[model samples]
Target: MGQDTKYIVGVDLGGTNIVSLLMNKRGEVLERDARLTLAKEGRERTISQITGSVSAVLEKGRELGISPDSLLGVGIGSPGPLNTKKGVIHFAPNLPGWREVPLVEILTQKLSMPVFLENDANAAALGEWWKGAGRNTSNLVLFTLGTGIGGGIIIDGEVFHGAWDTAAEVGHIIIHEEGLLCNCGTRGCLEAYASATGVVRRTVKAIKEGRETILTDWVQNRLEDITCELVYKAAQKGDKLCSWIVEETARYLGVGIASIVNILNPEVVILAGGMIKAKDLLFKPVREYAKRYALKDAIEGVSIVPAELGDDAGAIGAAATVLKRKGLL
Candidate 1:
């Protein structure tokens, strides 16, 4: 493909969904599609599903009179502990039984084009850095506040994978050395308190311990249905317990962010993911706490903001990865 032809394809693969985007080299989306992952059929089937989705997008592009041969390439963002260098997924806790899958090779062979793989969180960060909130900033950190906290860091316009390809794992950063237990077998990691699951877990624990709260009445037998949105609504309705739950969660997130500030000193920090939908109910407290805890100079000129790309961040970042790989950016 000619350098100035300006066409790329990006894919975001999640435990429950697969989304694809056709974009110009400038990162603007021309077309997009999303479908359920249906991961129950196992790794190979899941891979096929991804391939099918990508094929569908290309077919759509053809219908739009966009030649598939003119496409730059494909980029994919997926759950991590992956080897970006080799485009191999070592083990994705989110995707059941997927071990050491050579995803890049699979997609490349199927598409007859170059394919790149990166952790989803990292891809989102790159997306933000390239065309969203992190625009004009080279040093940036992004935290995805979803089922579990996921993180990505960009230093000098490149994603930092660290020595173990898990360098920017801000979620695992221990905010409380003896606090909550994490799925990774660690205690007090930031994810255990700030993520959607974390907020619900804390609320449930508080209620179980006889803390007076309205959540007790609002929640039925099924605690799993109690989402971060429910908590935010309860807080907005002046439920003291719910308010406390959100505040405490924000405090933990802020402290965790402060630590990132101290360590990486990124120019911008962006929050993305489902929980960010709470709007100011969450961002205000997190900003306040960050101000209180982060170093004066570090927090002084640093920008902390919500991600602007929303659901498109991962796919956009995946597309940017193709640009980066091709030395276009």
Candidate 2:
């Protein structure tokens, strides 16, 4: 097969889902598959799901007249405190029983091809840099604001893996002193204030304190059922408490982004994940606060925008990792 006809597979492994894609050299996805991760079923079952998703995509590629021999390899974006150099998952909080698993080695053995691994957030950053909002920019920072916040930094078209391969941990940045507790056992972390979990947590506290808001009625007075999305929806209808929560969330994000902007001076700051659904309500204040707190010169010409690739960012970024390693992208 000619080099031009060769393809690559990208896999995004999450606790809830495993998404796989087959892509040609031109960065077009030719085939894709997704399946439940069933991570609670243990490591072996999760690995099976990963491999099965890969096989499904490859089979679809075959139907498209693509040969298995024309495939380059596979790259995975997995949740981590992992070692990319060793392709070992030191541990993943979301994927229980995945301590020091030699995932690349296992996948390479099972699939009979080269395999690579990267932190999912870093892969998403690369994906955005290559084809999404960060395209045409060499330095970019991405914040994935979901249940918890995840971050990825791209410097000079490369994922910035710091000394311990744990760089771009933007969520843990201290935004306040002795403030709200974070899941990571730290107080005042940005994730404690800016993530979806944070928004819901704060709103729940407010409601419990007898702060009046339509969110309680929206969630049928079941405070435990309240979600960040509900908070945003209520805010859209001019619910005072929910609007305050949204604004607070945006302010927290702004403070975090300001710190990032001051330090990295990235060309673009991209916000991804479920919280982006809040759209202007979240973004307008975030931009304002970021600009307010950031260095005047540094803030100039920087664009803070929503991520474009959405769910596909991780998978596409995983493929970019392989192409980058192979010097094809």
lDDT of each: 0.88, 0.93
Q: Model 2, residue 259: displacement in angstroms?
A: 0.5
| Per-residue accuracy of model 1 over 76-182 as CA lDDT, tens digit each | 99997899989999998778988899999988998899999888999999999999999999899999988888899999999998886887888898988998899
Per-structure clash totals for the candidates: 0, 0
Error of 2 at 164 (Å): 1.4
lDDT of 1 at 161: 88
Q: For model 2, how does the per-residue alpha-carbon lDDT over 98-187 read when each residue is reduced to its tens digit? A: 899999999999999899999999999999999899999999999999988999999988999999899999999999879999998989
Best by TM-score: 2
Choose the strongest candidate by lDDT: 2
Q: Kindly provide the TM-score of model 2 when superposed on the true structure, using C-alpha atoms.
A: 0.98
TM per prediction? 0.96, 0.98
Clashing residue pairs in candidate 2, if any? none
